[model samples]
Target chain A: MSLETLSENRSFGGTQGVYRHKSQATGTDMTFGLFMPELAEHARVPVLWYLSGLTCTHENAMTKAAAQQLCADAGIAIVFPDTSPRGDDVADDEAYDLGKGAGFYVNATQDPWKPHFQMWHYIVHELPELLGDNFAVDRDRMGITGHSMGGHGALTIAMTHPERYKSVSAFAPIANPTESDWGRKQLGAYLGSDESAWRAHDSTVLMTEKGYPGEILIDQGSSDQFLDLLKPESLAHAMMARRQSGQFRMQPGYDHSYFFVQTFMNDHVMWHTERLI
Target chain B: MSLETLSENRSFGGTQGVYRHKSQATGTDMTFGLFMPELAEHARVPVLWYLSGLTCTHENAMTKAAAQQLCADAGIAIVFPDTSPRGDDVADDEAYDLGKGAGFYVNATQDPWKPHFQMWHYIVHELPELLGDNFAVDRDRMGITGHSMGGHGALTIAMTHPERYKSVSAFAPIANPTESDWGRKQLGAYLGSDESAWRAHDSTVLMTEKGYPGEILIDQGSSDQFLDLLKPESLAHAMMARRQSGQFRMQPGYDHSYFFVQTFMNDHVMWHTERLI
Candidate 1:
């Protein structure tokens, strides 16, 4: 429950704080970066949680997204958590997408990973609870957004717990991880061979089964290398089948990289702010 | 002088291009990232050259600085060159500061570094030539900025060739390297023990010797761990002695890190835009 202030600096007329806390779920110290707007002095601000993708830590979203200015303008606080629990003792995979950098925002039930890879619990329960207690965040006005796999995490998490998130969006998210190679490999290893369980975490399936009341905004790049694996069409089909009010837009000549994310990040922050307000 | 386009993507309603070229200076394939605003289609835009500090490649500023939106808003293009030349044939030192990451933005006269450490020629001359030929950048309207050691680069380069740079700024820059441990170590190794020759690259000394007609803007964090080494007062004194209009602000409770850079980056972009326009 104790948090260590690793580093704190003032940026863009806002305060950026990096904190480390021993996670009860992961059994390791986890680090996250938060940007609190200057407006926080007047009243509690809406919170936006950003999940990063493969080969990324909390630092990626914190540094690269270029989201703070818009968040500051919109009077929103942003939190960035490590992609996964990491330590010399913590288990890791040689592959970039399976281990330390790839939490996939799922509660792993598999061996070696079950103990420290409870990212679902970390993001949804532990992180929000911690932020609410320490920072002046409007818990009821929380929103979520992310890049790539983190996009998938935001979509799935928000869809599953609509009451917990007032808004949700993604940048080049893996729409149907249940059908993608990354999804099949990660979900199989983390949740076992049960295809039924995978559906619970697949944003497309979640959209069809339990429609989100609020609009689900997604931006996918046409040039993204992972387009074959992301399959945004599946989510589009699911939304249409369910008569979902969410909007899924495919951006032209973009990729599944930070360049794409940074380009559209302000719009995402603005979108979340509109809903949070 | 054929450039190989490594990657290109659209985001935040702009184009991010990564390119590599076999440098006649560094004698290796050097990489740089450029962000072109949508406004470039209609008119040639002012350019901001961002030089990174120690242990950073072009990737650091490209991924971490979060300057693209501000650049886009200001209708400015950002060019980030790799910190130093790197290849199997390139000479290197075990220390992070000296060998690969420490080009020092000077034409090295020493043996091992002389051949491949031509960052001065690369950035000041060759880069502008290439940008003029290949990109929609107004060569006549350009500005420079950097962080830490790169701050030193921005100041020295702009002052030395005021014709090339219309404005200049830095974030937690090492104001007077001649008086700092990092600068002395790098200068001694790269430029030899000739203390007089070092003045050409020392911003404070350059300000006193060759006064800049325009104002210089700098933001230094009061809590920066390297404040003792940075010596902002030395630079301030030199600027004052020369009667140069410079804005040197010491921000309270900040540090010499990217968090500090991202916080005030918009101001730098806006500063350059004002001068460029």
Candidate 2:
């Protein structure tokens, strides 16, 4: 697919750019942020995918994550896909939690959303191909991470496609979305009342049932306003029940904002870089 | 004056807080971002003031500048002041370069802006006192830096109050605003037609007339669209004519954006911290 360069800026010794492309999976014009480190100019580098939380465009993590310096040092290229498909014609709900910016990184099976909310196929399949074909990215050494809703996407996507991403991590992720109110409402709307269908997209359920071979890293803020809805503890319990290796850290005095994400961004980038290398 | 804590978040082992208080100089409620390094709780740490460019709120640098981690490591408390006074009651112009978001960091001596555009007094006098009284900041060990219009403000303010700020630097600053269109338009409206008043606010003119003590650092991006209007070379020439110690660097691929500011933010913070220590 042909991509349009929306804007580009020199940031942290890298080219931080935004691009627009016609996506087959989403059936819409999708935009994503791509940051190419100076090292990418000379050789292919390990690529990391960052999915943003609800109500965020590609700009949120691009502007707020503070990950470029670390990624530059690690010689990694990071791509940030928008949370959901956007545009006037796309089906959107008035509430922020259900539509537009809240794709939940799943292929919708319901009407009004199924037509344009195939973010699962978009991020997992189409986006990586587009980046590999157009940019200096090594498809073999890919890693994935995100915050909140995007975190759910990261875990489930990584769990289901272990061969695609070498490392996986998240910040304040909605671990057991099938059990939480946020997850129930979104899953109910998009996947209908079939509880079993929701289990495939739920990280906690995926971990207990499918079990990831690699250790998954997660950072949960104790002060997150949506901590109850996130239910990170449930994921920990599931990992323990399955005897799966996972690292879950509860950060004190932090919240469910970019401020929290940026504080530990260095650690996440380095974690992925070490594994990718 | 009592300050209302608008919001606070933990960032980079520091508290990134926004506060609002009634300002006597601007005759309005002014808000500023205060990043209190963890060291500040134990000691009165050195303070660094960051003035943003035109059409930016204090939040721009807070989110985009990516300076917190560096500042935190350097044990410096950074404060970001809004570009101009804002509110419904305050006087404003439709044009972005004038009125509300473009206070020019000077005391307005003309109509429509005189009452609430006294950013000069607000930054130099009232802001320092407020920070000192409300936070753990060392008034004697302070530094100032900015970008574009804010860079002009930093140069002039630091030049005039050399005893207050220990070090000064700017990124893509309008060095000789009096000689540039943006400067001429803003200075004319704020300081009236008296060209003499404009000289004090122009860094090039000020350096030539009253040379700054110690060294000043400036970084100008070669690809900056407003390079002609900024005239960093003019200031370099004036500094040389006066035998003033100033270092001016032209970055090759950078532009006039927060990306450029964040690129060199570490160098600037370390530069200021070295002098402060």
Candidate 3:
């Protein structure tokens, strides 16, 4: 796939670039934001892929979380992929929890949604191949992270492909789709109401089966309004029951907003950098 | 001078709050952002005021620049004031330059604008008093900084009121508003056609006459789109010519966006903190 460089700006001794490309996975034009540290120009660098939450583009975490300075210091490249297939030709939904912004990182198996809602392939396959070919990304040393819905994507995807991604982290992630109301409803629409098929895409279920080989990092806010829906405790319980050596920090007085993410971004970046390098 | 708390979020062990109040100076409601360090809960701490650029609100620098953790580490509180008066009743122009977002930080002396465009008084007098009374602010160790038009606000205000502000800094500030086209035109509208009236508000002219009492720090991106309009070299030259010691860094490959501002924000906050503390 040919990539189009939309914009690039120097940030914290790195290049923060916005790129667009034709995606065969989603069958639409997709855009992603990237922050390549100075190390990438000189030699290959480990990359941390950040998936955004609902109703967010590549700009939200790229700008709000401000991972460049830490990533730059650690000589790591950070990539931000879109939440779902976009553009007018793509499928639409009236509810904020079901449609364009809510990909749930799954390939749709139903009509009106099957053609474009293939974010699972887009993120897990197409984008990674594109990045590995174009950028100085060490495929062996890649890590995955996200916020909320994207956090669901990160955990499930990393759990499924532990051999590909070396590390995994999340901020206020949806621990289980099958247990979540909106998540269950959306997954049913995309996967044809097959509850058994949803098990492979659920973090709590997957973690209970075979825990991730490496330690996982999770930061959930104590004051998040969406705390009930997220159900991070269920995943933490599953993780602990499986004897998973993960770090689950419940930050007090924090919320679901980027402010909460920014407060602990340095810790996450450094954690990934430590394992990545 | 009663302030209504619009919103407050916990950030970096501090409180990031958005407040609104009926301004006696502007004759309309004004909003501002404040980040009070946790140390302020027990004792008064030094405060830094950040003025935003044109086409920006108090939220822009607060969210994008992200100066909280560093300020928190240094135990300094920070405040953000609005650029201009707002509401349906206030006078506005079709253009982005001379209207609501472009207050130019001046007490307008011209028609239509004279009634509500009293930003100079609001920022220099009303805000300081309100902050001092409400927050745990050390009035004697206050500092000021801003970007673009707001940078002009910081430079001119700090120079004129040296006794009130101890340290000053800017990021690509308009040096001599009287010489620049938009600066000259906007100043003419806000302060009548008399060019002599603008010298007091121009950083170059102010620095040339009596230089700031303390060291000033300016970080201008070498690749800034508004390089010509900002005229940072003129301000640097004037400061140097007056034997005014300051730190003027030309950051290469950076632009005028918040990306650039965010990159150097930690440095500016630290610089202000060193002087403030």
lDDT of each: 0.86, 0.88, 0.87
Give the per-residue lDDT digits (tens) of candidate 1, residues A1-277: 8999999988778889999999998899999999999998788999999999988988998898888888888899999989999999888889988989998999999887888999999999998999989988889999999988999999999999999999999887888898889799999888888888889899888887897877777777756788778876677556544545554555656778888999989889988999998
What would the per-residue lDDT of candidate 1 be over residues B1-277, giving only the tens digit for each residue? Answer: 8999999988467888999998887788999999999999888999999999999998898888899998888888999988899988888889988979888899999878888999999999988999999999999999999998899999999999999999998887778899889799888888889888888989989987886767687777767788778877677556533445555556656788899999989889988999998
> Which clashing pairs does model 1 show?
A11-B263, A12-B263, A263-B11, A263-B12, A264-B12
Error of 1 at A110 (Å): 1.2
Over 4 Å off, model 1: B1-277
For model 1, the docking class works out as incorrect
DockQ, cand. 1 = 0.01
Model 3 per-residue lDDT tens digits across residues B136-211? 9998899999999989999999999999999899988887789897599889999999889999999999988987
Find the candidate with the highest lDDT and give its number: 2
Candidate 2, A150-216: lDDT as tens digits: 9999999999999998999999888889889879989988888888899989998998788676767
Please give the interface root mean square deviation for model 3, in Å. 24.8
Residue pairs that clash (backbone atoms under 3 angstroms), model 3: none
